[model samples]
Target: MNGKIIGGFLVLSALVAGAAMYYLQVYAFYRPVEVSSPAAAIRLVSLGGVQEAMLTSDFEAIDADSSPLRFRGCFVTPMTLAMLSETFETYEDPTPLNAPPWFGCFDAERIGADLETGAALAFLSEKNIHPGVDRVVAVYPDGRAYAWHQLNESAEK
Candidate 1:
């Protein structure tokens, strides 16, 4: 009778310990941190004469101007892609933040092309403009355009 009671108590304690370990691993260890920021927004002019806008950070607060369409997602322009790839590689982590499974394709050459194209697009978009081809244009935020051009020229290798 004594032996049977001791065996039952051991089994019960083992089950409780296993349950606690499972709970901790599932709920406490694998959660991702929430992101907050300067609030990135993207506005695009589609080829069909439609203007699309997207807001990141808090996607629920989307509003559309003119058309009844609104978007709530991050833009993956060339610059952003290059930055993300570089960040991931710099960290030397096999897995990167918000990276897709096939992110290995973003080598140095690909990142350079993406950054150049993205920078051009960003410059045009700042002035509510768009470029027909992938070319760089220097723009200043405070309506002084010459500074960026001068900087770019000086930085050229």
Candidate 2:
């Protein structure tokens, strides 16, 4: 009886551990992938006196067959993510379907590509489309540009 009970308990524990690991891996799939670039290595000084910096290149920009431009950046801070959510609410157009208010329409595939690549900075800065942040820049395979916000001389801590 003692041997049977111990065997059952061990099996139950293993099952539970396996389930937990599976859940964590699935949840982490949506999380941003780490990226690296010289342009991504800079500190942002906000008007609110907040010092923000990127620890890794968590953003990317990729081209999708459907959209003219796609924007994707990591949601590292709640504030930055909240700002993006707000942009979707106020800036997104209703009739065109997935069109950025200031920029033209893009397909979901392109958006997904942007998310995969990390081009959020460039999308906002181009054409002087300011979303009211510290800096907005876009990098291409060829070159990079500071489209909106200026950079400050602060190292990433």
Candidate 3:
């Protein structure tokens, strides 16, 4: 009876270990993606109408003309993407929903950061995202924009 109990325990342990490994390898690791440049993002949005580039650390993206309610759209950087992946490492992917799985954690206000843009750009280059700089486009009221240009695999989210 003792031997049977030990055998059952071992089998349970193995199953648990296997599940842990699968989650760690397949889901936990951050799979870096190459995001498009801010210049490109600007250009894409400009196709609809003239758009402005906001990358300096001194000022946040905003429209002084009106009471800024929300950003119309966002041009996410590779570094920012990495940050999000790390931030939501354990978050369950909101699948079967049409919206972005990780959008829940994204804050548009954070993207206007000029102070961290420099550091973030450096990190982006190391991750193989070329011309790592402020590839930021903040959509304000009356601002024209394009669809989000992400380089990561959608299924991963």
* Model 3 weakest lDDT span, ten residues long: 90-99
Q: Clash number for every model?
A: 0, 9, 3
Candidate 2 vs. truth: CA RMSD?
17.0
Winner on lDDT between 1 and 2 is: 2
Q: Write the per-residue lDDT of candidate 2 for residues 21-127, one digit (tens) a residue.
A: 87653332232213453334434433343434523232432222232222323223223433433332211111112322223222434543543565432322222
Better of 2 and 3 by TM-score: 3
Superposed Cα deviation of residue 24, candidate 2 (Å): 0.5
For each candidate, give its TM-score against the true structure: 0.29, 0.22, 0.24
Which candidate do you rate higher for TM-score, 1 or 3? 1
lDDT of 3 by residue, 26-144 (tens): 34542222234232222211222333232322121211112111212333332243432233221111111111233333343343342134212211111112222112232222222
Candidate No. with top TM-score: 1
lDDT of 1 at 21: 86
Tell me each candidate's RMSD, in Å, in order: 17.1, 17.0, 16.2
lDDT of residue 115 for candidate 2? 39
Per-residue CA lDDT of model 1 for 1-157, tens digit only, reads 9989999999999999999987653343332222332213333333343434422232212212321111112222333423322332111111111212222322323333433553312232121122212111221122111000011222233
Q: What is the C-alpha local distance difference test score of candidate 1?
A: 0.28
Give the Cα-based TM-score of candidate 3 against the true structure: 0.24
